[model samples]
Target chain A: MNRIDKKEAKHLLKQMMQIRQFEDAIMDLMARNIAEGGSHLYAGEEACAVGAMAAIRPDDYITSTHRGHGHAIAKGGSLPELMAEILGKETGVCKGKGGSLHLADVSKGNLGANGIVGGSIGIAAGAGLSIQLRGTDQIVLCFFGDGATNTGLFHESLNMAGKWKLPVVFICENNLYGMSVSVERACAIKDLTKKAVPYNMPAECCNGMDVLAVKDMVTKYAAKARTGEGPALIVCDTYRYYGHSRSDPRVYRTKEEEKSWRDRDCIITFGRKMQEQNILTEKEVTDLEKEVTAELEAAIDFAIKSPDPKPEELYKDVYFESPSS
Target chain B: MREITYRQALNEALSEEMERDQRVFLMGEDIAVYGGAYGVTLNLMQKFGEERVRDTAISEAAIIGAGLGAAITGMRPVVEIMYIDFMGICLEQIGNQVAKIRYMFGGKTTVPLVIRTEGGAGRTLGAHHSQSLESWFLHVPGLKVVMPATPADAKGLLKSAIREDNPILFIEHKMLYNVKGPVPEGEYLLPIGKAEVKRPGKDATVIAYSRMLYFALEAAKRLAEEGIEVEVIDPRTLLPLDMETISESVRKTHRAIIVEEGTKTGGTGAEIGMQIIENCFDYLDAPVLRIAGADVPMPKSAVLEKLAIPDAERIYREIKTLVS
Candidate 1:
């Protein structure tokens, strides 16, 4: 893997901060009853999505999970469209039909945020197979939580990808609990990566709070997959800052445990590192924060001003242009 | 012109489509070396090789999901789910994903995938193996469901389904696989969503599809012997149903008898009956009659299974009742 430079490190830190702030604002909106529907906040797990995306090219594809705002942001989905989508506005991605659970930008190769657990695993494998058949060097990054590992589709897709040497990197953000059930209680194998070994694929575990560590591991595995070395699994052991969704108060874990993980927050840890290296001053970081906050505020305003989709428009787009229409 | 089995006609359609379009491929369990559960894809592996005529794992969800992914990314995938009953495993991917992708994506994406599966009872495969779930798919808004009753239709309709831009659920009756009929040698296409009047008459119309169409034809022959002329109609495509052809026949005949092999309650026959009543009620001389399978799970016993499903005798009795 190549060494990360000062400029690249700063950019990574900014992305992590952006995700943290965005999720915080979403939690606040949900609390105030302003944002309709629910949201799966990706606060503590930002490092995994940011680092993995940073390792891949813009053309590489990714299949996201229901907890997907971070992945969408990291994959370059516009913040305004994402905000509008959460608000169920017509101008949003998927024309607001998908809402928070299903956000897709196929043009950028973000397959879609899946609502079904482990549903996108096979889809990602198929995309990788397509890339292999087309003779393109593009790799597909399949993202899922610990809960998805138990699904039959996950094992089936992994086995096929292993046998066919499909270009894909399976990134498991093991956030300890799959909704309310802990991975230890649900899984027979405590080490999540060990599950990959049965399929004859190499596996590794990384401290997901450290973006640089995740970036380094993903870069190596993604390169191997691109060169037809077969699929690899990277288990990023992390924690979610908030409950599973807006409804969960997170009675599953101790408050002390949550605070301990929060102490090693990815955003603060990376920001402190930048300061120590003299790469960024406190004033510059504050300025970046201000800019990001204003940008998100404007995005909310855009979503509010966007007109609702017309009722007659509902019948349109049901089929690929009906024979007569 | 040539004569071929319905299974062979379907195989030729698949082989021709694969040869004509590089993006077209076939995937199913044992479909590669073993040819297929019913031998419809026999010798295709030798022609297209493993990469194109691929055999899949027993994961129905993965099979359909792979087809959905491949179709969206510029490929025409024909997936086989050996039995229609097995569709329950992949219903989410098929119903929620493949069927809704085009509409949900606002028509930006096209899923040109065909889910080929066999339905109906005859070989005593029983309960799970012998069920007609075409009505379940027909109820869905975005899916196009097709069932061919003859060799010519098996070839032409399958070709049309392969050329379609939406997800098509192509159903085949397990009993009709070996039935022989005339099929043109050259390339031919059948317009989907159109009904063909197999045997025209002016007394009463018998609407049927798949294996039931054969029963309807047999009933028509018996009715003709008694001098009570009957019109036999096959609405080959269930979703984009050919109401125009069916209503025209009902108008001329002044009565209708819908035949189906599925359970009578809420079956495809019910849908056809409702459509005829809604569209051609004023033209009908008698109330629409439906001759369908008994409202019970198909039995494993050969005698009980035969008694459960609709046959030629049942069709004849229903048509006689409607006309008398």
Candidate 2:
């Protein structure tokens, strides 16, 4: 059964709310020119990030993609630092060096967002190798887009993770498109799970809009991987509410498709499901939204008032201090 | 003192470093059972077992990417690319991720990764197999470039590089793997950014590294016989270049010449010679000359290959011209 206690379920709802609100606020900032840098919004894909992260332990690893604010939020990243980072402030998680596309909260097991397509796949394999060699049960949840599966790194890393049986889960956030090009135009076959066939990895496709379904499907694999059953690849059939970036006009998709996806907004549906199950009251769900709003408002205030990285910090942090450099 | 081949010296360094640090490991294509392309990692798998001395698939990006991943996660990984020419295939991982991660992360993490690869043309491997790609990594800020000319330096510098907290591109010459040189027994480590005056003299200062270091020494020996004495200084560590040593030598000799096996266009010699002009310009009696390889790819013909790279005769001739 796709079940969890009311507290954990409400926790998932809160994280989803944080991601949605944060992404929406970023769009507002970009419109007003408050945040000058580019941002890949993750508004509609909240369930996939929250549900998959809900299955893993806090100490476990996660390698995120360019659109990674949702993953960081679900992985226990501080909203203040995340906001500070996106605003290019010194108090940010990466000390302001990594902006939107490179936000990393390594202290919380978030390995940062990658700017390049398919960049984090191989790194996920390496982290898995680290766990395997060190005899740890920590599994790395690697996230990438449908477009990344076509890259050579995707093939090489998957073959490696399968051959070595490194404990990892290759999560495909298949929102049906790679930027302007739909997956139908880019991929030869529409079924994305078939890409894992040659690697001999156990694969599945789940309704990414449902947090319970995503959590149930991924929890099984995460448990199996911990028991030394090797790796698995999964597809989360989700959608991004915004364009590839802030400036992308999103002329590729039809309004009907957009409305259909928004009709099943993850937060609204999941909150309704919780209410029907008697897991929480409607008043409780409203309370969570109120808490999230206060949190995001505090994060915004902290980000706006924070100072920029000093000009002389340029030469710093190139290399960490070791015995020899 | 024990005389060993450069290949043997590198193997010893790997074995000792893995023995000393449990966090240290090796990963690459054909580096385990097949014993590395140049045999530098021979017998390491037997000594460290399959887990520590990992044999990877023929995926350059994964090999390097995995190394970076392991490094930032508190493990020390020494990964290998068979040929320096092949580094171009995975330059994104090396340049963008491994090199820039520490700086990009604001020093919150350390990437203790060492990339071992071989370059230079000698066996007529053509353009694809042999290339001096050290200058490419040198251009990346977060990377350290090391080229050890002798077997002793190779063993010592590889140890230092393995212990280094940053990404290091350790370039070896395919031609120098078999060359024998004296190496201290047991364990010894040389500092990464220091230069040594191989042969001191009064006429000119020849700055070289890798195989070019030997060419400069050969030229210095012959020029010594002609009373046109030349000093040879090897800048073993390329990134934190021992410019102080080179400038001090140039101040004494009043002449500087850079010999490199890579091409003259945008080569290491150009960078080093320009630095000499900028740092020690007033001390120079004449313009600093760079004796680099011909501006062409490594060809199939041995004669053409020989004519392309710098030799002792060419170094000696270039020095004679600069001094007179």
Expressed as tens digits, the lDDT of each residue in B13-115 for candidate 1 is 9999888888888888899999999999999999999998888878898888878877776678899999999999888888778887666555567778899
lDDT of each: 0.87, 0.90
Ten residues in a row with the worst lDDT in model 2 chain A? A316-325
Q: In candidate 1, list every pair of residues with a backbone clash.
A: none
TM-score of 2: 0.98
Per-candidate iRMSD: 3.0, 1.6
lDDT of 1 by residue, A204-272 (tens): 999999998899999999999999998999999999999999899788899999999999998888777
For model 1, what is the alpha-carbon lDDT of residue A246?
A: 89
Q: Lowest lDDT 10-mer window, candidate 2 chain B?
A: B129-138
Model 1 DockQ class: medium
* Best TM-score among the predictions, by candidate number: 2
